[model samples]
Target: MSAPMPPPTTLEHARWERFKSKLGGWSLTTYGILAFAFLYLPIVILVIFSFNDSRSVSKWSGFTWAWYGKMFQDGQIMLSIWNSLFLAIVSTIIATVLGTLAALGLERYRFRGKTAVDSMFYLPVIIPDIAMAIMLLIFFNMSGIGFTPWKVNFFGARLAVPYSVIIGHVAFNTSFVAIVVRARLAQMDRTLEEAASDLYANAWQTFRRVTLPMLMPGIIGGALLAFTLSLDDFVITFFTSGAGFNTLPVRVFGMIKKGVTPKINAVSTLMLVVSLSLVVVSILISMRSGSEDSVTIGM
Candidate 1:
């Protein structure tokens, strides 16, 4: 009979491999938990304090809805909220349109200085906020334009800093939206558009029917991103905003400078919820679109 073969190397390796893999997985899990805790702990405390009856953020006197009531009852807070919402909505629409066009032009067309153009679009995102703020302030000052609100007598109506904030938001938000839309466009298959064109479809028709549908996820995602950024922007808005114009973020900053209040916490909690909801919805929509595409391809 042949001598018993030495235990297979594979079997010997498997024994140690299982133990190492488990250890590695445990380490990764621990790290994830620690990271999540670090990021969310402050948010948790803020939310908890929003319901606290006490004026102090450090100590909770009792649970109450007084802060929430105060948040709404405070005329300044309500006005700031309205301003922020208006700015976000207007900026999101403008950014989505401009960024979508920019993405389409960049992705579908080739031209001189294309890379440079792309870099310029990304500059806002990469530059420091303070630098952007100062540059905008100086630009406004140099132009000899009053940073004050403009009154438009359209049909016997008046408008003010609402438009100014919206303009500022759109300027910064467009770059971010462009980056997001461009990323999505890059991942898309160019063949789809080619096929549509080969089927006797005009450029506009092909884009509207085939490309736009495919790009919807990106468009919506980018719009939501722009909205959130506009809502949360402080530094840029601070420099660009006219007198009597206050976005929610600027209002919050002002209040915090004075002192932290439960009303502020309530407002913060509400904003956190809104931001989180938008992000979650966008992610879900993207995931669903991806899943549908996968199924279509598989079939």
Candidate 2:
């Protein structure tokens, strides 16, 4: 067979190319709009419906703040909120300390099986929540820690918190915090630490004065992320909370099973506000610290 020649330059070919280019642009624009609308339109609706006067979340009723007032006045809701706050704060603190240490160790040092250890740190982050919850439940049961509440006295108010739930939250949150802090560490300038060392500063002094201050933004971001995750977690919380134990997320789930109401919407809206506030604070910290690259919460 004879070799075939390429298509000749023609007016029709030029017009086809122009048509394809316009189609590409329009398609991309349409998809972009759809993607944003898909993600955020529901959130806007949720916020708007939270003000509905009627109990029906799906129906548009006259605006009223009664639901919000009722939400605050509900003792169970207030207790759940308090429990959620305490759990998140405690878990975040523990996760931040451990995660920062892990990041520092993994980033600043190298050793045998270092790669293996690094991979292990990511398991909790990548694992399914249900699987982790089951494992934690089993482990607690086998270890004789099953559903035992830690009798904690906080500000003169005695609280019985599930140790397993806190442990589970810390377990997963540590990995998230480690990942974020590691990203920050990867971007940090090591020269500051070197200079401090050259100035005859000891290890602790160097870290306290130079390293920690620079790492503060990343640490704060990681802590906030941990707090947000702990606060919003329902699966693990519900599974490990045992009978009569309720955090805000678990309580929300129970209410959802009963049915949706304007009070539920109000409570959900409050939670949304809190989660969004934490995210905003993390971003702001990164921005102010000139380390916007460190807020890798998606990791």
Candidate 3:
């Protein structure tokens, strides 16, 4: 054939392959850096500005603790914080218990219309927050569920908190808890439970000793998620909370309507700290339990 077709140059081919590999790696590294910067830069800025002495959020004044002091002394802010904490604690506890039982029932038992029940449980998690908020508002108003705040005297300060807000939080929080617990249950090794049963253990005993321990990690994760969601909730709480009752998020919204300030920044930063701490704890628990995927289920 024409000069017997020159043999392919191995050196050139190797060089070209190496070039392509290097280019691909560089591209991936750049993308990762850019994505991280985009996500964290704003949070960093917020945290930094929270310490600014100036009232204006955009301007960076010399560092000062005045805002933190103001945040602590502000009665409205402090009261809202307490209300948020109370609502989160109550809703998380209720949601976790109900969600755990539901998960167990669905995973362990086969019943008619199980698919439909499961879908109904998932609706809150899938629906938009605004739509759910409006629906809850309409339902509460039509059903005549009292939005009246229960007035209580706490350490000399008069406080009023609405029970309807807690109910609304529980409604959505239950779905998240169920999803997380269900994911954990689905991934669990059934052999352990079977072994317990084979050893002549009763249903309650087997569940108490084995099932509960295994499920604890997921339960904790779900509870933390529920607490975070309840603490951060705005729309549902806003719609369900009657006049004069405000959680931290609702309080923040009202403040925003007035205008943004360093005081607001301080409140936001504190909230961010709490939320981040809860998320970190949940992640750690999931990692320790060898069920990293459980953390993402609620999300």
Candidate 4:
């Protein structure tokens, strides 16, 4: 038999492989650095300015904690912070429950116009925030409901505006939570449910004991996403919020527009720290969960 001919590695193939490897390596490093800078540069500046004694945003005076102390003393800021927290918590709860149920339904059941339904749920996410805000404004205006501008009842009782803002936040957030939970559901193993059913477990029992546990990570993740989005929301809240209803973001925007101050920087820095810490904690929890899952599988 003749000597086996070596398989040909064409010049084109070699060039393509070299290009891919080089491009992948360079792109990862370049993009990683860019992403870090994009996210953290503003945060770094904010933190630096927070310690500055000067009220001017650009000029740095001696370091001082006066602005932070002032922030604590400002009752409006404190009230806005509390309001934002309450809105986020309530909106996240509502969004998570509805979104998780929607995900489960979409993943486990077949129905008419399934693709259309998915697209509808995702439409809110893709719609421009300004447009959505405008639409919500129009809808609320046309609803024939009495728009009470503001009235201070006993104990400073407020009405309507804050709740409307929460409704808008929840409406947008539900779509996001649905998408995240749906993605998680798509990747889950149907065999587990099938096995549970084979073992004579009813549908509810299987879902409660087996499906729910597996879906918890995605549900929690979606809830966190909803909470963050609600906290960070500005446009919808601004449009829907009537007098006496100011969210943290809207308040900060107004403050910045009037004049930049170290107090604003301090608040921004605090928000950045909280957001980053939440992200890190979420990632750590996810990794720990994944590791535990792998160990269980191995066992």
Candidate 5:
């Protein structure tokens, strides 16, 4: 039989516990720093190399704006950028309106099959982008909706705009906007709307005067989110882009297949800046609106 273990001395026990606690904290901090570096270091490198005078990304080269100039001069790249911007703007507008309406309907009224409807709206958020892209591709092919591209004349250049791609963007973006707007609606004070009704205000008047203004931040947030998603989207855009059309991401993918260059890095850096700016703006709007809500509730 084994002998019973002796109790640890109080002073020794305290030192051991302290050592373990410090070690664990240090390990976590180290891991966090390493994880962040691993994720973002490549982006930092890419941005830095975009300004490289030499084409090699791995070696340090004198700083220059040559890549940026090249990016601007490349007509195909410029066209892709235009397409991306156009898609983002149109999709954001369509998504915001439809999503806001959906949010209002879902939040304000009780309806049969509400849970299923809610799930359907959220499905896009949870679904994998590749799967959605493939599904969209198949649907567009079967429906023959996006086969013909609309030719738009832009400063003597005619570009084929794929309507199906726009439709797919709206389809996915609507769900995201609805989710954001629904969250804001959930936090809103129903009493304000009630007060409006008690004043004999019509539905349109009440919405315009009371709810719409209050919901503006959320609406803007959702629109920005939709715009960012549409701007950065690759998989869906690639699949639904049809023939003879390319968004920036698809263009970048094609460039990568051929070769990598500082010009590609420059384009990526610009996209990153745009995406981060949109996110920052959205966050600021949400925070401001949250603070306002808190103040209103306090009153």
Candidate 6:
């Protein structure tokens, strides 16, 4: 007997299926556009208003760079900006080193209570900023570590950055860095390290020659993220900085209490640019690293 013939597709059925497919495609595309608009529309408004000639944020009188000039000229704002940069840079460096080491140890070693330690590392990342700030504040008081500034003449300008604040920024930033580096480690090929060892390279030599290069992208990305987080952090800085210390975000909050101005908009725009630039640079670096990694793996 001949195999049973399948039923022929009717034109209406074919048209219905194609229509459904097109509908689904259009629906997803529409949703994506709307979602992006919702997320970015406010940012677009902010950037535009930052250039407004008038002080009124609501009314667009004209365009001017006056606010930007004012932002730079304001002594307190300038101080805050410097403080933010200092905090971000210092915290990022410390967090990246600590987190990277943690990632390597956790990935390469099997130790008792490793699971618990790993979970604890992530606690700071998941905890609310307010809670973390409160916890840090309480800990500092209990530990007899007052919020004292590490006063130094930085680039001929004096800055009084609080030690407690630095520690607070580092505390949470380390978790973010660790998570990013650990992800990179998980994607890496272990064979390269083994090959390096087989070539009579010491542990440090293997890391310096092979592992570090592969991990550099993740390390850079994590550092950027930590820097951004520290720069933008308000709650922890506010709680930990104590008396006179002020970061840009904390200054912004203080400015808000007085009233919103075009100067605020200008500073906010500057921050937005810095943050977005860092993120973009990190992504580009990561993509380049990924390409390099693939080429190395193939070789």
Local distance difference test values of all predictions, in order: 0.80, 0.88, 0.86, 0.79, 0.86, 0.87
Candidate 4 per-residue lDDT, tens place, 39-149, comes to: 978878889999998787788778899999999999888767777777788789998898888888877789999999888888899999999998888777777542333
Residue ranges of candidate 2 with Cα displaced over 4 Å: 1-20, 153-158
Tens-digit per-residue lDDT, 213-264, candidate 2: 8888888888888999999999998888778988988888899999988888
Error of 1 at 102 (Å): 0.9
User: Per-residue lDDT for 24-91 in model 6, tens only?
Assistant: 99999999999999999999899899999997998999989999988888999989888988888899
lDDT (Cα, tens digit) per residue for candidate 1, span 43-121: 9999999999889899979999999998988888877777777668878999899989998888779999999998988
Cα displacement (Å) at residue 169, model 5: 0.2
Steric clash pairs (candidate 2): none
lDDT of 3 by residue, 83-187 (tens): 888788878999999889888888889999999998989899889999998888777777766786767665555667677888889999988888888888888
Enumerate residue pairs that collide in model 6: none
Best prediction by lDDT: 2
How far in Å is the alpha carbon of 19 misplaced in model 4?
A: 15
As for model 6, its CA RMSD to the true structure in angstroms is 5.8
Clashes (N, CA, C under 3 Å) per candidate: 0, 0, 0, 0, 0, 0
Q: Comparing 3 and 5 by TM-score, which wins?
A: 3
TM-scores of the models, in the order given: 0.86, 0.90, 0.92, 0.82, 0.89, 0.91
lDDT of 5 at 25: 100
RMSD of each: 6.4, 3.6, 4.0, 7.5, 4.6, 5.8
Q: TM-score: which is higher, 3 or 4?
A: 3
Best to worst by lDDT, what's the order?
2, 6, 3, 5, 1, 4
